[model samples]
Target: MLLRDKFCLITGASKGIGKAISEIFAKEGAIIIATGRDLESLNLMVSDLPVYSAPHLVFKMDVTKEEDVLRVFNELSQNKIFIHCIVNNAGIMEDATLQMVKTDLIHKIYNTNVLGTILPSQNAIKHFLRNRCGSIINLSSIIGTKGNLGQSIYGSSKSAIIGFTKSLSKELAPLNIRVNAIAPGFIDTDMIKGMDQKFYEKNLKAIGMRRLGKPEDVAKVALFLASDLSEYVTGQIIGVDGGMII
Candidate 1:
């Protein structure tokens, strides 16, 4: 039990990597606070989590909404449910070449992917500051590091997350709070399922492993970051990309 008795909150927890993280954390004995806008999907996910000693909760939250973010934290505090880690996994991605990208779409991407991460992170920092210890694991992407076709806006949003994680890590280090980001590459998820087969094959060939990454792969790295295994790690962008960037 890497996270026995710990309380972890994960955003975008209805499916894909976020859902995988929720299950893995629960399996490791952590009480999960799974959040997403999809109530039905979230409830389904909660039902699927491993039964543990500590209870798990599911919340319908929009990370981009400041009020919603504040309410969730406030309610947790009122209940004395002190959180140990926050996984900022809520994000959105829409593909469009730079020339073909619409302004509204860019705004939407940044609002959800960038500001969505920040709102929850800001609320979590307050809790961590009071507790004097906590972990923040942010979800980024390889596209943020290595530019990809038709993903300029999405890449920019994730790039902002990388910067935010690095700076916040340094600011919160002295307070015993750790912040880090994981950049995944071509994980098998709904997002990837929508990609054209040709593009998928191209990415598959580029990956050193010659296969698509599973959500569990990223979840394992996230578990490491959230648990004591990464006590001395922070401000790092770990790529769970099967050496694709190389």
Candidate 2:
């Protein structure tokens, strides 16, 4: 019960890492607020969450839209529900070499991966500032630190997240709010399944553990960061990459 009675708001919560976070948080006794653009998938996920004392909620939200983000938070505020933690996990990735990259693709990546994180975060911090304490867990990527062959735009977007997490952690520390980013590497998710087998196998060899990570691996770290275990930690980019960079 590491997060008993805590209210955690997670974006892109329909599947993959976000869904895993929601499930783990629920099991830990947190009231989950799962949100995503896919209404059907989100609803299905809500139904599958482990039963806990506090009820969980699912919202069809587009994190990139300011109005949608504001609406959800405003409704929560009106209901007197305070979010204890926010996992900015909503993101998109499309790979292409720099020469082959299209401007529209770059825009699509930044809009969802960058601005999507910023909008909800702006709303969440207001709540945190008022409460005088909160945790902001952002999703960065190992690719952001170590550039990938065909992920120039995606890497740049995640790089922005890393910078955002570091600067905000410093700014919010005095207010008792903690901010950190988790950079996951080659997690076995539907997203990763789309990669070519040759490239995937190459990545596996590069990993110290010689295997791809699981969503649960990232979820466990997220749980730690969201709970008191990481109360003293902030402004850090923790890599869940099986020592890939090391």
Candidate 3:
């Protein structure tokens, strides 16, 4: 229970990696503020977590909406729950080649992936700065570090997130808050389900482990970054890619 009684806010926590992280955080004795767009699934997660009773709070939110985010934060603040860590994990992937991309899709992906990240980070920082002690973990992807065909839009958004994390770390270092990014490769989630066969196989073959990453792999890194174990680590990008970057 390295993070006993800590309050963690995780975005996109209805299913997949987000939900997995929430459960892991809870089992580590952290109270979770889990946000997701699907109310039913969110409720299920709140009930499914392994922690003791009342360790989780679920908020139905669309990460792209500033108003929704603001309202949820306000509600949490009013309840007097201090946020100790924030995980920015909400993202949407819409892939198309440079020439084949639509203006509308580009805007949609950026709103959900980029702006979705920026707004919550800004909001969370307010709470973090108040305590002068907190951690912000941005969920980036290996695509941001290396390009793949038809991944221009998705990669760009994630790249922006990683870039933002680095810059934000410098800005908030004096406040005693750490900011970092985790670049995960081909995790077994629906996000990877859409990857072209050739692209997925090429990446898997490149991995020294000869396997795809799991949500728990990323969740473990995130837990370390969120806890005091990473007190000296900040403003960096770590890959949970099974040595693919090697």
Each model's backbone clash number? 0, 0, 0
Query: Over the full model, what C-alpha lDDT does candidate 1 score relative to the true structure?
Result: 0.92
Off by over 4 Å in 1: none
Task: Report the lDDT of model 2 for residue 207.
Answer: 95
Per-residue accuracy of model 2 over 1-246 as CA lDDT, tens digit each: 899988899999999999999999999999999999998999899898887777799888998888899999999999888899999999988888999988999888999999998899889988887677999999999998888888989999999999999999999999889999999998999887788889878888889988889999999999999999999999999999998852
Query: What CA root-mean-square deviation does each model show from the true structure?
Result: 1.1, 1.1, 1.5
Worst 10 residues of 3 by lDDT: 48-57
TM-score between candidate 3 and the true structure = 0.96
lDDT of 1 by residue, 73-145 (tens): 9999899888899999998878989999888898889989999999998888877877679999999999998
Show model 3 residue runs off by greater than 4 Å: none
Model 2 error, position 111 (Å): 0.8
TM-score on alpha carbons, each prediction: 0.97, 0.97, 0.96
**Candidate 3 lDDT for residue 165:** 95
For residue 215, what is the lDDT in candidate 2? 96
20, model 2: CA deviation in Å? 0.6
Using TM-score as the measure, name the better of candidate 2 and candidate 3. Answer: 2
